[model samples]
Target: MKLNKFWATAVMASAAFCGVASAQQGYPKQPIRLVVPYGAGGPTDAVARIVGQAMSTELGTPIIVENKAGGASSIGTNYVVRAQPDGYTLLVVAANLVLNPATGIETPYDALRDLKPIAALANMPILVAVNPKVPAKDLGSLIEWIRAQPESVPYASPGAGTLTQSWGEMLAQKYKLKLTHVPYKGSAEASRAALAGDVPLLFDLGGVTAALIAQGKLQGIVTPGAARAPGLPNLPTARESGFKDVDAESFLGLVGPANLPQDIAAKLNAAANTALKNPRVIESIRSLGLTPTGGTAEAFGSFLSDELKRWTAVAKSTGIRPAQ
Candidate 1:
């Protein structure tokens, strides 16, 4: 009886090992869902659809882009956080995934703790623009104009606890300027407000503001990035404008639930990198005023960690608090 029991135990272990091997080998048997934690037609959603289509071709599976926007992106992000560790359910999010929690927003998942970074997809600089009526042509002029104003000038952002708000807050704190934040529901509304001169100053994603800048509706002052964005080459970077510490570009990436199997993660990462190499994908991303970024999973993970730390420090210094 003891010998028979030992043989049965060994057989069970062998079967379990084979099951794992099979799962690893046959990953993504069905369509993969790529959740975008923002509204449709936004930069994040655009990136997801572009990258998802390319990834599907590489992986021999359909990649579905689903937008579950709300709660400052916490709702859709949390949905992905609770998803199975299997690679089918993935998330394509902006830097807000880290910025939201750093700025004291109540997020259901810890970005660094609950998600596995699959790959870095793109980087989009935040364009600092003003209504043509602001009378500021560049960053220096804008700073001086704001300082000369008798009262604090109002600025519009996408919403509270978003990267747009953080950029405005950081600018106010760093330059000692008096700027009041007017949070709008999303980029479209905020852009409209800026265009209408409802707010004299605006900070928003380059993609969303590029067309307006071209049309003379808004003047592109400076981009908060280490370097100038390709689409906005005429604009200076924050670092070049003498605020070296004001680097606040948005990084978009792919991630999955924490503890995602290594093989599956590697497969997705490889697929993403392959898709980024496509010329059509490159043009599509650039047309939206975003730079394509493709790197190893480990590199993306490290970038996310560094961004979290950086934003946490920014939040503390700027006194940005969680929403009520």
Candidate 2:
């Protein structure tokens, strides 16, 4: 009886090994869902769809996109963080995934602790645009103008506790510009307000504001990035605009619930990287005023960590928090 039991246990171990190998060999046996933590047609969703399409071709499986927008992305992000660690459900999230918890109120999931970052898909700068009627032609003039009328001028953002508002707050403290903040439901509304001259200044994603600047509806002052964007070659960066320690850029990427299986993460990473290399995908990103950035899961994880640390300091210094 003892000999029979030992043989049975050995067979079970062998079967388990084979099962794991088989599972990895033909991974993603079904559709993969890529969740975006914002509404459809936004920059995050646009990139998610492009990358999802590329992944479908590379992985020989359907890649589905799901948008869950609200709570400044916490509602959707929390859903993915609590999802099964099978890698089937993924998130295409903006910088808010890291920024909100670090700078805003309580967050449902710890970005670094509850999510496994898959890749850094892109880094997008925010544009500092003003209504054409604003008495500022460029960065220097804008600074002077802001300095002159500290209390009267106000800036609009996608919402309170968002990157847009955070930049506004940081600018106010860094430059001592004392501009009031007007939060809108989203970038579209904020941009509209700026266009209508309701708000003289706005900090919004470059992709959304680039067209307006090109059309002469708004004037671009400086981009919140380490350097000028390729599409907006004439625009200066925050550093160049004489603002020290205020370089900010929004990155969009893919992340899954913490403890996702190693093999599954590897499979998705490979598929995503392959998709990123496609010429059409590259063109699409450039058209949206974004540069395609793709890399290993570890790199994105570190980027998120560094951003959280950086923004936490900004939030503390600027005294920014959710509206009462």
lDDT winner: 1
- Model 1 misplaced stretches (Cα beyond 4 Å): 1-7, 322-324
Per-candidate clashes, comma-separated = 0, 0
* Candidate 2 runs further than 4 Å off: 1-18, 150-152, 240-244
lDDT of 2 by residue, 1-324 (tens): 999999999999999989877876778888988889888988889999998999899988898999999887888899999998876899988887777776766777787899988888877888899998888877779989988873758898887777877877877777777788898877789999999999999888876677788777899888878767758888888778776677788888988999887888888888888888999998888778887889998888888889888778878887778654
Candidate 1 weakest ten by summed lDDT: 315-324
How many clashes in candidate 1?
0
Model 2 clashing residue pairs (backbone): none
Q: Against the true structure, whose TM-score is highest?
A: 1
